[model samples]
Target: MKSFVFRQFEIRQSADVFRVGTDGVLLGSLADIRNARKVLEVGTGTGLISLMLAQRNPKAEFLGLDINQEAVELTRLNFESSPFHSRLKNIHQDFKTFDTQDKFDAIVTNPPYFEASGSEKDKIARQTVELNFRELISKSSELLSEQGVFSLIIPAESGNDFMKMAQENHLFLIRQIHIKGIEGSKNKRLILEFSLTEKALEESEFIIEKSPRQYSDPYLELTKEFHVFKNRS
Candidate 1:
């Protein structure tokens, strides 16, 4: 697919990089960006999440970083074509080695969760060969401002371990939502938000579909601002 049209912006995905998916969309739409003046997105594949955040927070400046040159180019193109281009920037750099004196008010990512199990492209895009959960949490802790928030969506199976690692780094979980494919399906993904300050964890569940090819009401309502669907009544 060359491009995908959202309610506010159109994303160009001509480059052979990780394309936008449900996980990215969910994280982008659900992540809290209130009072965020500056935001950083690690592994910003095609800059989908950053673009969404830009649309949501017009005053916020965004920087999207990715190790893959192709992904960087694609994100740059996407950012440039959007209305919030002036507020957005895309850089070709690994998050681990990316040096910046500035800290962000919010850091978001949908990282590679699986261990290597697919093609070269898949491995680079889906596996944690470059940045694992531990390093990701540690780096976010270092680069985030005192009141900054870090948000991500990961596999449900790894949720407990990820929370443990985050706690070890003093990044306390503030909110979380478990995602299921259907009403009765197993939880597949977990969307979590963390902050440096300790707080009570708020938990919830999100179901994507009520039936085959039919979106659940909650999912539709949550994403109604961005996505246009048929028979959403």
Candidate 2:
């Protein structure tokens, strides 16, 4: 298990169930949720994004779904123990199989990106529960209401493929934020927001750090609530 103790919340997550990482935090902070009423978090492994959104948007109701029973249980516990408990609900089910009559105002997810470097012994639940980039985009297109937004954090290398899939799904890119870990390091993640309404795409780059263990102000501002290191500086 991995433990993350933030200033306002504590998260206990499994190593296999896509541990709450920098990508998740980036997506949560950068996603636009000003007018969101109902939000869906697909594959909410530890309810990290759900909880974050709940705190960020007090008026929004969040529904988090996960394929693994253990993960759902963990998320439930986390929600109950969190300050945003009233706004959060966790369900144990796969996003593809979960039935919903109502469409959401916003959908956010930190999906699993299967890399060749992962080991076979890695938790099967994590690998199997993840929806591919194409799957997430297409599914979000179906579940999001008109003018609704879908925000996602994925490997930077896969941004082109994801954008293509979004276009194929009739979802237009509203914003794209390329995230780099450090000054000289390769871009590691991409934070994207999509909607049905066609609009000029807004793009920007975010560097997480200046050097090893030296975080940038933007990174610190976005992650101040979750990273202890951000507060220590």
Candidate 3:
């Protein structure tokens, strides 16, 4: 697998772990972490999102968790190699049973949403076999500080259900970004931010591309600090 090179750090990928992708990039770029002093990433595939978040918020410390042993090792390597390594840590543990006394100011994840079993390469990292929406929401609410935010990128179709589940757990929707793969296409993904406190909701839309192969200006600008593109002046 090719390593994803960011301006200040590089994400080393592994075939056994979920590769860095658009969803993780978007979460890392767009997740609300400005006020966060401690952040927890639920499904740290390659530690890409946490690395991006750490780079974005210099004062934030990060802890990543993964159930898969391979992913844990992979994230460890990526975190140790990053410039913000001193503030990053990861563990191999299933989030459901993982206990901690520390509360996080931000909990971010690019979670696997597939409910049906698929014969995919990284099935555990790509399916909800181990962790379901209900468990994730309940656990996040417990782990978050009073003013903490929980953020993630998942299928747009699942947004309503996720928000509802979050609400049941006392996590209210605060921000939502409807994401389209291309102009004129339906919103396929959603970036959601929730908090324990009820506040005014922030909503927006993002288009990844204007055409099939061309990136939109908004997408480019949002990721300009991280992605190293070719043929740029």
* lDDT top scorer: 3
Ranking by lDDT: 3, 1, 2
Ranked by TM-score, the better of candidates 1 and 2 is 1
Ranking 2 against 3 by TM-score, winner: 3
Candidate 3 TM-score versus the reference: 0.97
Indicate which candidate wins on TM-score.
Answer: 3
Give the TM-score of each candidate.
Answer: 0.96, 0.91, 0.97
Candidate 1 C-alpha error for residue 84, in Å: 0.8
lDDT (C-alpha) at residue 163 in model 3: 85
The list of candidate 1 runs beyond 4 A from truth reads 231-233
- Prediction 2 global C-alpha lDDT: 0.83
- TM-score: model 1 vs. ground truth: 0.96
Alpha-carbon local distance difference test for all models = 0.90, 0.83, 0.92
Give lDDT tens digits, candidate 2, residues 71-166: 888899889999989889988887777787889999998777764345664443334335667777878899998989999888888889889989
Q: In model 1, how many backbone clashes occur? A: 0
Number of colliding residue pairs in model 3: 0
